[model samples]
Target chain A: MEFRGGWDRCCGEARSCRMLNLGHGGVRRLSTVDFPQTTEDLSLLYKYFAANQAALTRNMKKNKQLLEEIHVDLDIQEHLKMQEGARRFQQVGLFCILLFVGSAAFGLYGNGVVSKKHLTKDEINIHFERFFRFQAKMGLQIQATNDRDISISFPIQYLNHFEISSIVPEPTETRVEGSQVKYAFKGRDELTATFYLVPQQIGQIKGSVNVNENTFSISHFIFP
Target chain B: MNPVLRGIAVYLFVYVIFRILGKRSLAEITTFDFVLLLIISETTTNALVGEDFSLTVCFIMVCTLVGVDYIFSVLKTKSIWFQVASEGAPLVLVDDGKPLLKRMQQSKVDEEDVMEAARLTQGLRHMTEIKYAVLERDGSISIIPKEKK
Candidate 1:
């Protein structure tokens, strides 16, 4: 007999082929049908299959427990992977924050926010510098050790724009050399010379006095 | 300007900006968020230092900032009002498998976030399986699954 039209053709001459061709959906339909089968039919089918009801139930329970165990294990592994990723991210974030804070602190320190230079009196005396705005009186103290009168020359390189007609404590001799005034004076022993400067422009004044090849320079600023 | 005063002003200004932007602004980090954070820091650095370049000033500023932060933390711990003002209270977004739509909308938390939490914690596949969802103060969603029948 040819078994072809679903369950109606089962148990026919083609029963074995039909059973093999019945896929998962067909098997599920077959189970639903068997659920309402008569007791005699169930017993006959169980006998034909040669399986005890107790053994089938035990095997089914065992498979279900195994599946649940696998699911739980997979879930735990996934959770652990997520936690590991999160922990790595946290570590990287913490490292970045620390690096940023360190960079900021270093930047502040490098900008001179914490330390400053403290110069000594000798250094300042050697430099002999003063800053002034507009006109101001400036004095240069020169100490002479020998009794011989020493001639000194001060190069007025920064007072070109100033009114030289109003200079105080006039120099003994003033000579012009390439837009610069060379003020000469004679000093014996200790001497202090005072000069008055009136600025007519907005800029800086950097002048120097040459005494026997030793140069003493002074810097001043004129504000607008 | 004094370093301590400048530091305090900058700290307060940044604090106010973050507070106005709300807590969710920092809950998740995107590329844009990272760039924005860098820009904010660069601007703050310029404002804090101006033209001054002294190591002592920087040290004083850092000290003042730490002191202010410590004082705020102490105050927050001592006073409930300060705590509430600084850190918001936890909000309930779901109760007994029903979504509190208004609360969810206000908190910017949608149903998907709650469902994701349920799935992560309880292997749940549907929103109906969750009994409660709370938006905690730390910006995380806490889920409670419905009892199994």
Candidate 2:
């Protein structure tokens, strides 16, 4: 006789009967509890899971592609903005460089020469004493050297307070050799004097002079 | 004997002691941790700078402490039970938007403190907006928002 039951009741009855008839040899023939049956059920479940996994993977791949596209779009937008910023910076940089160069050149030419009268030896000496005393109070030592041919008296001051040391009249001079006076004072001491001077219609003077060698050169001549 | 080596040894020893104290020690950081740190620093400083101190002893102590720390870190990571025991479980201070006054008192947390934490983290102006407020293992408050849908 065949028995009919609802799916839940049938499943429940099957579980109970399998448990009760566990040791009986006839149970194997009546029941679907063998390894093969279990394997088959598992295979079907595996297939279902595999298919679900495949679908999930495909969805994930699509999502990743979408995200990558979005990232690329953002990167391109950022790149374009950066390029615009760089262009503006370049324009500004060019303007600054041009302005700097032009002003520098004008300053070089403006103060290039000094046509003023040369200060006499006595007058220079007096000025030197006053300058030396002032500088000595500020912790500096001055040494003077006189060269008659050039009418130049170079007073080398040891500016212990700063970095550079030379016997040059800086920023102002009567004789304009590229915005500087060529002056040197030499005495019994082998201490060489250097000259630095700036000419009034000429640019500033910035160069070293060798008093012993009577040699002078212009480093920078800014024309105003 | 070198000042540098001594300093390093002291630093290592201190690091190990602190590590052994665990994360909860840092989270709570009571007057105890501060005092411990101060005493440890004071004791170790003389040894670190003194010529009489042995570098070998210092390094050995440091290595031993560091080993202990490593073991604890490994155990905490591998065993969930150990992690829970070391860190402690979260205390529920609020359930269903209602404040659990007993739990708050037990946890040593006041209503004002909870409110401030909620406001700072979630902009929760009213207690009614909170679904659940859990005091986490780290002594920080975790809030769960009510399900809207």
Candidate 3:
């Protein structure tokens, strides 16, 4: 008579099953009773697991030793180190290249390979912005035609080392404030002034001029 | 307008720019980075030379740059502070099979980088097998494998 059942039941019915490898070297055979059902079985399984772990550790050591004998890892390490060293050397080389190019540029540009930007009176007037410096000569130019007395006033605190070098038309009168200077001149078609000044300290300097009924202000920066 | 003076100024400016960009910038390179660097050099070249092309000016500029570079190298060797400031110290990314996440993040290093180093150096298959991973000064990783029991 032939009997049919689930795989585990059929295997259990066999006297000595050869259908599966139950453990290493096939020392054990597959059986439904292998499943732990009692404390004793559970303890036996735990021992099996611990033995397997120890065997795995031993095999890993052997594998490591074999790898060391071939020196494959060391060769790879050396090659990688060489590549890293080459890359680092390349970076230094790039820095040197930059320095070379920069130095060459300095040599050429400083000697006048390029011309300085020169602004026209109209350009300067159109972009009438305050200039900046630590110490510099400041030139002011104005145009007026109305027949009347006009005066220009500026803060004296902007200049630490101050001097008034030249004025196109001498002022009719001058006044001094605690931190300001006022110069009165007869309104003419054109006027110019050159001032030698040094900044008191590092900050923005604001100066204003009042002539007739118009007031104008300028601002600048001083380097530390 | 002296070439030597110009050379000094350009050197200082370039050094500061690179320093500001940070150290990792030198380790990795991209195509756009190459193009941008070329453009920067072209622009700064004109500002550096202005209009001068004299042989004497060229020679002096070269000499001054070399002298300054030599002085910096000497200083770096002599002073620990300068060395630390210019070239950063080596960092440890992994200790005893565990990754130091913060140091790795700060240095732009990662687990994959350490793993790669381990694989290359000791044929390690997993991060758990590594005992230590050091990020060297030149931006390379050095890995030490766990001792076999």
Best by DockQ: 3
Please, what are the lDDT tens digits per residue for candidate 3 over residues A130-199?
4333333444555444556666666665433334546656788889866767778876555443343444
Poorly placed runs, candidate 3 (over 4 Å): A1-126, A131-224, B116-125, B146-149
The Cα RMSD across the true interface for model 1 is 18.3
What's the lDDT for candidate 1?
0.53
Give a tens-digit lDDT track for model 1, residues A17-127.
244443211121122223323556545543433343345447747653211111110111212222223334445655766785675454322222221212223212222
| Candidate lDDT (C-alpha), each | 0.53, 0.43, 0.55
| lDDT by residue (tens digit), candidate 3, B1-149 | 45677788888878766654445566655799999889988887765565677787767777888999999999989986666555555555665555766557656678988887788888999876776687765667888776787
Q: Model 2: per-residue lDDT, tens digit, B1-149? A: 34444455556555544333432345555788789778867877556544345777567556655666677689989986665554445556665455766456545677887787788888888876766677776668777755565
Interface RMSD of each: 18.3, 28.1, 15.4
**Pairing residues by index, what is the TM-score of model 1?**
0.39
In terms of lDDT, the poorest run of 10 residues in model 1 chain B is B16-25
Off by over 4 Å in 1: A1-224, B120-122
Compared with the true structure, what per-residue lDDT tens digits does model 1 show for residues B8-75? 98898677555444445577678999999999999988767765778977888789989999998999
Q: Give the Cα error of residue B113 in candidate 1, in Å.
A: 2.8
For candidate 2, the docking band is incorrect
